[model samples]
Target: MTSDGVTTSRVVADVARELEIELPTLSSRMASSFLNQIPALQGDDAVTQLVVASTSSNLSTVIDVLQHGIPLHQISVPAAAAAHARRFAQRELPVEALLRAYRLGESQFVQWCLRLLAARSLDAAELLAAVQEITSVAARYIDQVCEHLVDIYETERRLWGQRADAARAASVRTVLGDETLDVGTAEAMIGARLRGWHVAAVAWLQSDPSDAARRVESAAQLLTEAYGRSPLTVLADDHTLWAWVSGTSRPRLDEQVLDRALVSHPDLHLALGDPGPDLAGFRSSHREALKAKAVAQMSGGTTARLTRFATVSISALLLDRLDEVRTWVGRTLGDLARDDEAMAKLRDTVRIFLQTGGSFTDAAARLHLHKNTVHYRVRKAEEIRGRPLGDGRLDVEVALVICRQLGGGVLMR
Candidate 1:
């Protein structure tokens, strides 16, 4: 305790000085930790260096709060931290990933402090007080800084969205937002025809673009070129691109070919809508692609990088009403809704069983399980659902489809 009225122990002050001295090492280690846990946070060499700067600034801020007993309200996010947060937002990186980085960093900082304090020859009470102060300060500092960082992120994201190829984006947004607009006028604005069959698609990359416009256009072109030529492409944001490929005939899409092509462009995620005819098709098809994108985003599964509207149409339609879907899924599946590998395997078997008109032989062939094994899984699934699979079979089928497509998005949290 300090009679100087700073409300901080001299021991804490000394620790803070030690932290400042070790700032370079601590910052480097935590930066590595953040990237290791969430590889999406990594960037080019330039960005990796900036991450260390931000980490050092954030860690230094926490030390200041501990040493000075700074009030929560007076604390401000560091300039380096704020700048990197905005950069992350501009890149459209997952905000959840960035926020989680703060919590992980906080844990590391507390452990370091505790280890340093344990080496002191202090009495039990003093050691306890110092531990309490360090833990509380680090936690509170993270909370305060993260809240401010979110505001910075959101504001920058909104502004960044608004600033991307605005004229073309507004044109696309206008067409998508309205159904009654004249097809000719809309075509004139977008420089694309709406009189024929249309297949809409959304393409995006998680990494920062060296040449934003051209790279975004190339992404859209890659997804749309198979169906039609001179597709209309619009920049959605720094990280996303939207397109519509049109032709007189509805084009056939071979999923295998698409998958093979995407193997080369690892960063690109493509979502496609079904073929639709006319101006209404132009609008509706885009909505379907957006829906597929929604499910893909929720899943965040790399295997789903190439989502087709037809494959996930059911879950896409229900994405907007997911809160209801989650509740209904929980009710329909009962204990069967448990999110785990074993339960998932059982659910898949049951769904196949139901789909095959309760033919154990067919289900077994589809699942590569013996007929006896298929029967056992069906019985086990029924046991978990606490009822026979006879009633509400339709609802059961739909719920299984939802879980299969949505992954853990609608599973019991």
Candidate 2:
């Protein structure tokens, strides 16, 4: 052995002899106190094993540091940390609980060390050196173990989350696909039934469509919370989530629930499908949400974060013959299709006027305008089109409806 090794071995042996009687009791008390402080460390065999392994490894590290002047890096603390973290990950325990337990153990160990120094009645100079040694070694050990464990925990957690997500996505694809899979089997896989009134919703971010998958999950979680039930959720991509809320008795989509969800997540864009019954409803609902999403994009929907397929069904179907619809709108509205504040205000007046069945008084009340203002806009609209309302009342109403739904797309403005 080298001279250094011989000296280290002698010093370690001396300290071991001095603490031999107290070491077992000290370790047991420390472990007990740590577990008491972190009850999450109990209730599982894997957790118990991790606690035991960590306590023993930490005790060995501190003793070696104080006695042989061995470095913290040379110890098996990293392996212990990795093992403990793996156990926590497997048991699906929050990493915070493990970290809290470690902190508790650290405090208990320091308290034990201080008590030992006081009981031994060391001189002032000896006490100072001992205190310095305990503090330095304890700090280094705690920091090293925590750092190693945290890294391991995060890495393990990310891998686990990715695997779980991939598995769920695959199952959802199977159920949504045309494959001849049994509903029960699919339910077992996705943890939700297909035999119920299902209202499917797709959520995404407008700024970054690629962020769809992650943002969609947040949107789905918000929906689940508002509905007061767990919904079947699947990430269609990084920026899109498809989810369904169901009831045994066909339930209608509650507007208030959707309103609350939108209020909470202002930036989230949600497209919802009409509720349908049974497995066919499950497929149709998602299909309808997809259609609604497409129409919302074309219409330049402002304040349309929550687009319902039922509400947009007419527009979504009309979008199929968009070229023809645009031509018809141009012919019917003529200069009324102009994109400006004045034209927009005029169009609103005409729309409300027609909707109220040519009642100028009602249109004025609805638009919060005077009766003269509604009458003036209608005459102006007719003059711009070069025809009276009687000549093309049906065509004018249809054109106005198209403009309202398609916005600038059909208006060519």
Candidate 3:
């Protein structure tokens, strides 16, 4: 009972009343500060208007509670406040921005109250009590409002993310399907350009499937890091991510980088397609990547983590008829296709020798062996096959590639 002969309650109430009148001014100032600080909030005219409305509503709501004696538990977030938070979630704006806005607003509002109290004819202790009361009430109101809004924002973000993912998945499926697509429309639907060369990739996690969405998406991004832009990625399933990168030219896969990524990512496997051009090229490239993935899956990860369509084209085509491929590999390479370490070395050396057009020196360089060792291995491979190197040169080379790519899948065990 002591501020310029005014009771403490009366003076505080009088100050709250004055603050109520200044709310419009306060809302405008805080809203400006929010836009300046949060670039995401700075949007079109309609968005700016929404921000003003939400800010004003929030300021007035807090002022009303301060001027009157309102119980916090009875309070709910202002409709405009809920709408603004939902908008942020729907637009994919981070919740951190909203929380930051609240923090800034709280500080400014408390300072504004302090300035007004300082202007009043009050003693230091009285001013401190009044300021404490206003600050506590304002801070508590903001804390309660922010907590509720956060719950709302999180709920909306989850629902929005699911809907967005479904829409994106549908668009991807339409583009991949045989629907007689218009390239322009398809590109718009998929939200990525269809021009230039396209390199398609399929990524999946081998373990830790619970983090499938995050880890699989990371795998696709990791595989296409050389493209210098984010690839168009879609979750094909819980554990699989399909992605395509477009650029002026085809991207070269860095084997060392890919191997390093595998170690960092843990149990991640990727299959890649050859780069193709334009809309039709997009479909063809994806088909090739799928084939490559099929081959990789068939090998049960005994193959490399990064499987390329260029190396496994034959294996991909024959993946469906693996038994037939096994029999053919057995016949073509004879005993040379045996799943034994010594036989494997001989088979590989002879395959290199034949691929180099019977050049022992070239094969030796490729195998990191002496020319004499290459010649000796070729002789042993021919003896095991019961034929001359020229008898079935083409078939021998193809069979050897299949054996190498498919490993024990096609080799006689």
Candidate 4:
């Protein structure tokens, strides 16, 4: 009998007997087709024995038949067995499969290596040999996957960076006073969220936007390290850097930190703002810093420092309105001092008189004259200037401030 016919008959009989079910006979064509599909099967002594034994009535007949000579363990449906083998070979699969697992693009080189590893179970040397065998195919895939991975990683990093930037902007806005915000509301918003206070020392490098940004970033890193909490944020303007610091307390911030941080770059001129409680204070602190920077610039020296807005008084600001004050002064005191030195003396006397708490005796003592002389100077000065030095005490005070700035009195040039 043909091998396929014999084998089918044996299997059907054995199964029917084991389950006590009625046997269904297989047709010759169907039996032959099934047998032909088994891999490595040949008409040999072992095959003949298995077919004969499997048809017997005993339960062990099927087992004994296969044990005659064939390796039953190795024999299985080729397609199903191949699929099972592939599962075991997954890790060793071609580079293509590896790329797929890693979400990389297709590459023939990787796929060939996987196939070779599966077919031969090769070691490192053999694997390298397999890789070499498919070099052209593998190299292309490797290059493609590598490039794709880099692009994907960079894209993801940029996206995350944007997210971080947005968060930082929101944090800054919340700290500063919004249109609907009051001092109490601003304080409450920052109270719990902020850990400390800090002041940022900002400077720009030759008006180059890139260099300015780098300097700001470098200064921020240095400050962060020194204070262990303070961080700097920079706002860019032409030839200017608005450096802001955030920390818990101004006193707690270490000046030495800034000294060292700024030491590395000589090109930067740092103007430090007051330590802000949170980012909201950045605006105020920045404003103060800009004024301080202007003061530093006017001083014509690098070491000049101004930390507080109060250091520069409103009087100083008024003095800055010199052009406007000049017109008024010229109009009021025009030619009054040309002939009457006494008139000039009276002007100085009136300033002293008001400054000394309206005491004639104190004014006389300050001016090194008798009290009557002081009173006479004030009356004469008021007559010449054509203005009463009456209860316009506020105007007198303001005028005195301008006089001092303009170097009026005996020192007038």
Candidate 5:
């Protein structure tokens, strides 16, 4: 080492040793004062205790750095302070609260240093140089510590957020994956009971995945308010949310209220399950809600946006066997699926015709088409299929319903 470097090290070691002698008194005084004066650091809570403990440990580390001649940046203060900062962040303490404590603690440590120098009765020249060096190093140390702590605070904050989301998703998955709940563990995780009637829902963003979770959270809160009961909500992915509202009675989720919510968030789509009671009910309801969501997405219309499981149960079950369904649609609809626009008109006419018990006038009125046009399309449709429409009315009606619900998209190979 250079001569100047050796001399500086010797000087730092001597001053550090002297400071170490005062560490006990300094730590006690600083703790008592910071706890009493800084409201942020003054509680009997676990986090507050952590703050007190970290303060004392860090003070000793500062004194050791001077005694050992270690570079301030190389010292352990930043890492130690960062660990404490993460805990504070988790406890929801404000960053300002912690920064304020550091400022106050630095003042106390400097005062203690001045008192220690005076007690030793150092020569005026030596004391002046020591005070200057100590103050300069302490300032730099605190600044570095604060910088590192802030970075760690932000990083840990994001990590904690992700961890919380993962945990919540896992808990919700567990509930839906099985027929029974762990009762205490599941309830503790979700803050809701599984022993009551539950109306489950699956919601998703139609596009723009950003802010999807915010939409899900908003929808969950809306359900909570509308039902007058708390809900268990979990974001299953960036685009999807699974939620269930609980009550002794079923939730109606009034149509007007749903319409208002949809108006507020046009990109959001919701599918609700029929209410069922208890643990089995919770699982069943969620499954149905998911199925309803699938059918709604396949159906492709604004009216399908807020579908209920009870409305689409049969179609949803059929859609579960999609390959078989495609075959059935091909055989039954035959050539009716060929002309997209014309096929849609004929299918609608047939659906309404069958729905009205085969009244051509009523079918035309419902479709806004001429009665002759309905009859002509029906005959044309029958000719294309090479079968009389009345010979297989029931089969044709079912095929038409599937065509409407699943859309031509599912029929195109």
Candidate 6:
């Protein structure tokens, strides 16, 4: 029977007649040959029976017969049939057709092979032998095709790797710009979304670059886990890594995140910069981080050190320019009896007094001196400096800054 209730015998007769050949005898031989070659076609099913009946017929005649049930346009015809009159010849398949099929199937086949290898179900030696044996059959068909497949596979792998790298670069840029937080509206948005207000601190590593990179990554992860947000940005240079953390409070960060991050590495030192308000603070935090490192280096601190720009006293600034300030102090007050200790005490008093907003009582309290004792000291300082101590707030403030910048022992106490 044919696929759509047409008889296979009738189809065979029509195809043979169209091809000017004998019908029943040719149909029987073709059916037997088809059944032997393709076991699945041996059944007396409609589609198989029709295909068996048409095999010995001319390709066009067979196509016409099949078109009653199957679309004729979808059938591929043998071009050689038109060229040869006596014997039928097969058509050459397009190279693109084979290549397209291989491209679609190669990835799935490779994955299957990899999975089989990983499972350890197949012996490695046996698998290699089997592959070699299979390649012998493949080599008979085409030597260059196998080489082409290898080249194509490698090209695809490289393209995939490049795509992955591009994705990572995009992710890094997004994170650095704080784009995920919508930084433009950060203050309002963060306050609403976060459980509490956020505080930020920055730390930098000046030592090991690899360790610094790892630490920055770890610190970012830790901050994210604790705060439900990655408040950290890690900018890594050739020799340093700058890490910033933002959350609700300073103490929590100091105890939980920064302190814990540094606990394992005794040799690695960090400079923790002052906490800032939002994403805008990242730049400031980074700057302060470098400054903090300088401060730590000068101070000879063992552990990680924290420094705040706001807490930097005028004396600290003055001490930074100690030599210049010391020269000026000596030249300006040359007639005074030269006692280093006394001059240092006077410098400290002036720094404290100026920093406390010109309040003698506040300065004395910071100096831990009696009010009258502070008064006597200020008068003696005025006499030594050859200037009156009254209403000289600006002069005193400038001198204190200069003295602190000088880094002299004058303001150490």
lDDT tens digits by residue: candidate 5, 1-413: 12344454555567667767877766667766766776766532234445656777888788877777668868655444665787666544578878877888888778866776677655666666677777887788888888878887887667656756666666666666554557666677666777779899888776655465677667786676566676778765445677888877777676677767677777888888899987778878988887787677676455365888887787878854666877777787787865377777777787888888988999889889999998998788888777877878888888787777777435643
RMSD of candidate 4 to the truth, in angstroms, is 37.7
Over 333-359, each residue of candidate 6 has an lDDT whose tens digit, in order, gives 443324455675777786777678767
TM-score of 1: 0.63
Model 1 lDDT per residue over 1-413, tens place: 32232333777877888888998888888998987788767533234545777999888787887677678788788988887887677655678988898889988998998888888787766777787878887888888889999999999888877774666777777888676789999888876778989888888765665665566566654654455355677766555678887888886666676677777777778889998998999888888887787777666345476888898999988866777999999899998988888888898999999999999999999999899999999999999999988879899999998988887878885
Candidate ranking under lDDT, highest first, comes to 1, 3, 5, 2, 4, 6
Question: What is every candidate's alpha-carbon RMSD to the true fold?
Answer: 10.1, 22.1, 23.1, 37.7, 22.5, 34.4
What are the clashing pairs of model 1? none
lDDT of each: 0.79, 0.71, 0.79, 0.44, 0.72, 0.44
TM-score of 6: 0.34
lDDT, model 3, position 65: 75
What's model 3's lDDT at 83?
71
> What's the candidate order when arranged by decreasing TM-score?
1, 5, 2, 3, 6, 4
Q: What's the CA error at residue 342 for candidate 2, in Å?
A: 3.4
lDDT of 2: 0.71
Instruction: Give residue 163's lDDT in candidate 2 (0 to 100).
Output: 57
User: What lDDT tens digits, residue by residue, belong to model 2 across residues 51-131?
Assistant: 766777677667767776777778655456576786566445678888787777777666766766677644565666666
Q: Residue 144 of candidate 6: its Cα lDDT?
A: 38
Q: Candidate 3 on 1-413: residue-level lDDT in tens?
A: 44452455566778779988777777878898988788777632224555787889988887777777677778899988887887677555678988898898899888888888888998777876777778888889999999999999999777766755768877777888756888899989988888888989888765545566688888765866545556888866545688888877876667777777677876778888999998888888888888897677655326468888998898888866778999998988888888888988897788888888899998899999998988888888889999987987889889988887777778887
Report the Cα lDDT for residue 253, model 1: 68
* Candidate 4 lDDT trough over 10 residues, lowest sum: 84-93
Worst 10 residues of 3 by lDDT: 41-50
TM-score of each: 0.63, 0.56, 0.55, 0.32, 0.57, 0.34
User: Which candidate achieves the best TM-score against the true structure?
Assistant: 1
**lDDT measured at residue 176 in model 3 versus the true structure, 0 to 100:** 81
| lDDT of candidate 2 at residue 266, scale 0 to 100 | 65
